[model samples]
Target: MKTILVIEDDIGIQKQLKWSLSEFELVFAQDRQSALTQLRRYEPDVVTLDLGLPPDEANATEGLACLNDILNFNPNCKVIVITGNTDNSHALKAIALGAYDYYQKPIDADVLNVTLNRAFKLAQLEAENRALRSSNVAAQEIIGNSDAMIKACRTVEKIAPTEITTLLLGESGTGKEVFARAIHKQSPRVKKPFVAINCASIPENLLESELFGYERGAFTGANKTTLGKIECANGGTLLLDEIGDMPLSLQAKMLRFLQERVIERIGGRQEIEVDVRVICATHRNLSEMVAEQSFREDLYYRISEITLVIPPLRDRGHDIIVIAKALLHRFNDEFNSKIQGFSDCAMQAMMQHSWPGNIRELQNKLKSAVILADSKQISAEDLGLTAQSSKTATLRMVREQAESQAIRHAHSLASGNLSKTADILGVTRPTLYALIEKYKLLDLRTTESETQQ
Candidate 1:
């Protein structure tokens, strides 16, 4: 059973509340000292505080102290403060001090019950969200520090605040969906739901209704009113994955919604207003599509207001190795493998091979390797990559490969901190600086600062 602590100085009111709140595992304290003691003992999920306690029965000071103490102990706990009927100022102050809400004196039982119910519901949701976050997959997390990746991160941080339509352009396997989510998570609507739909996955006949929704009896299969993905993502984000494949007919309706912020569900007479951020991702060349009339010229302009190009895995230089190791650690936990790390030959082979499918391919291969490898260290054979037959020991190729591997590993171990990168490479801070100078790593590092109009 969930616990509640009631802190009030009035004996008569306490008895009345105790009877009313008998459904809860309730504990009471008549003063600040006793309240603190009870808080430690019960660690209750909710607290009902009357901001008029001993020594300041007419003031909010004593009650405010208890409120602060409760928050200090458990920031997740919901504290509801009771205040004078006409005084909204003290209630607002309690809110600023982290109280969940305030109830006026001479409290109506119905109103207070509603407020308590809402607070409890909020507490439960917060707990569930925390648990879910802790258990989420690491591959789902962004794990690259290459210049291309950093630039992508910076772009997301900037564009997430605006209502502009965003288009993420990338190769087939580069992580456009991940970047889209990062934008949503950083945006003002982060607290709301984020719904993702792949345009290429749905059949042409069903895509329209899937997005704009349908009315009851609208079609042969429609038995009930349904909210579409757009409506479901109200006040949040909607990721249109493989948006290049969105049917031409639906593109017109999508463009209407983008231009007007309203949608008329299929067979529905009234238009529905929705506030949603649209993030579109595709591997296709949309400009080329516009030239060919395959995609609407107007829709292309709208979605490309802020376009981000995610570099392919081979082009991202050292990021491939950084991403590979991250995938390895994730699979290790999931497959219950005793794999400690990658062997020298495995690392060499990973650096040599070109990643055709980018991060997605790397993750899949690592997941497979972790389950199949028999030894502690993963080797080249385990990764399913073999060294080339015409192996050249040219100094240029060897140094270039070593330098690329060093940059990737340093960034990974340092979590993208440049100063840490210098330290980990075992070169003097200035020597490491000169190496970054002698090599063209600066372009990779500085590319993150670029912004789109």
Candidate 2:
């Protein structure tokens, strides 16, 4: 139960408050001196202060001083000042001095209880946000110590404080968004919104409206005007994920907007100017797409004034174990499990296997392992690593899987346009055709006729 301190000089009033607020652990104080003592002792989340105190029932000087002292000691503690019915001036002054809310001479128990509950909830939310924020600060940069990883970190740290348009290149699940967040957190615009939109996630038809919002009555369901992601992130950072997947038609419009720094809603004619730091990320190679004319060369250059390529997880030798240990401890707390660490066999499996799915795959695997682990330590079996999986994946197998998945992802991003898919994969028409046939990636085909092209 949360503690509440009541500072009322009247004996009858104190009895009445204690009886009414039976839900909380109530501490009574009749004077400023006693209230301060209780405050220092209990460190209560809330306090109800009566402006009328002992030795000066005619004035609010003592009560006001006590309120100031309470606030001075703990800025986060929520304090409610009780005032006379006609003393609106004192109540307003109390608020100006950081009092949470004020109650008048006639305090209704139910009304006061509502305010107290709200204050407690607000305090709890603020505390959680602070905790989460601190963890975010600790995880501000990518966690890796390898040379390639260090190079990526240095590039991000070097470019974060600037307004330069940057492109993050890497395979899927390699933490491009994490790197983007690190950049935004370190940028001048850190105080502003860090809006992110996945181009590949949203439908091709609605993607335009989502990027640049629609006006009221623009569509059948457009009941109210809406601000797009770009406008919402004004004076902040905007991340366009899977930009290579952005449809061919939308690419031209996006290019125009980037060039002008202004956007017009789907049905709105007026161009709304935006001041956002645009960051683009994709597992697909844009330069190859540019060569094949699927992605506009101009747009690629505009977004990639600087580029940072995150190394694949398999290549970051020792960093895998480092990240895995940190994840184990975090998951331990989250699952309320006492998993000591990885078993020797589990560690061997982790180090040997090619992390095809990268960090995302690793995180999911660990999450399941933590949940399923019966012993203090997690075994390779806990991670679902079979005998075959524990064996090191061959270089050929790794290359084939990576290449096939990359092609399939590009096809999905391009919406099964073979021309665009070939462009995104940086392969000629013949090579892309051969890879698709070789991998049986026809599941990505939109229509059978298109595959023939």
Candidate 3:
């Protein structure tokens, strides 16, 4: 339970508060000195300061002084000033002095509890933001705690120490390069240079030269003998991003280099040996490309000696919120904005969106929102999301969609086991079959038949 420090001088009022706010662990103080002492002891996130204390109970002098003291001690603490019903002037002054809110003399238990709950929530959000800021200083590590992410990270840990040519398979904006850098950071060649080249972004003609370098006379305008990415990262790690986009003509040479650990620069006949760890990443399905005869099968097998598949943001569950908050904190510092956090609508929109562009899209949306947001909280509109449109979806449609998704997820987890799927969904096998049929999940039925076989 959350702790609340109540600084009130009236004995009867304190007893009434204690009885009403029994849900919280209450710390009582009749004066400023004891209030400060209790504050230091409990370090509660929230404090209720009655603007009527022992020495100056008739006036707001001592209570205001205590408010300043509390604020000075812990700036993040939410201090709700308790004042007389007609003392609007002192309440406004207390607010100006950084009090979270004010409660009048006639305090209703229900109303005070509501204010206290809000204060506690705000305090928690601020604390979480501070923690996220501290933890993401480097901003290079992978950020997710989902089972898929945990499993992928464990795989990276196991493979990083070895000199294996690993392949990272994932959708775009899924932080494939980040994982590559993580592997490089964990490996023996961490002190050496780490290089990355996007095969898809570079022209086919220039990609080979970029990877293996070119002699001065190899091509026109070739600056005096330049070292390529492979040679530049001789003793380090080289990330071949979007390797599936590399021209099929160059695949043979890539395969040869991978097999021999050597390369021949353009217009250079002699072979040059290079000691480097190679990591390849692509959003494309290389196996499918290999079957289509576009990507070389040998090269795919060679590079994918070890492969790690990164999970998409949508599948990561609460990690989306964790990542979104981390990004918010980072952008707040970058843009020097005091945007507190996301609004309820903004959070709901985020959770509902599929995140097709993943973290990159999230970062862009947040950066824009932080720069343009006028309010303390980022609303769905500020994030360029339409939470209202989702409300237009009929209740029946929403329920059916949710049910279909749950059944599909449970079916996947159970690996086509009808009984196991039913158990996971907390339904009978017949009910599961009925729902699957109603949802027209033909693939699942086929999988069930295959499993039975």
Q: Model 1's lDDT to the true fold?
A: 0.80
Q: Per-candidate TM vs. native?
A: 0.57, 0.56, 0.68
Tens-digit per-residue lDDT, 296-336, candidate 2: 88899999999989889999886787678668878989999
Cα lDDT, model 3, residue 146: 61
Ranking by lDDT: 3, 2, 1
True-structure RMSD for candidate 3 = 11.1
- Score residue 394 of candidate 2 by CA lDDT: 47
Residue 187 lDDT, candidate 2, scale 0-100: 86
Q: Which stretches of candidate 1 lie over 4 Å from their true place?
A: 1-140, 389-453
lDDT of 2 at 334: 98
The lowest-lDDT stretch of 10 consecutive residues in candidate 1 is 444-453
lDDT of 1 by residue, 197-254 (tens): 9999999999999999999999998999999999999999999999999988888889
Summing lDDT over every window of 10 consecutive residues in candidate 3, give the lowest-scoring window.
131-140
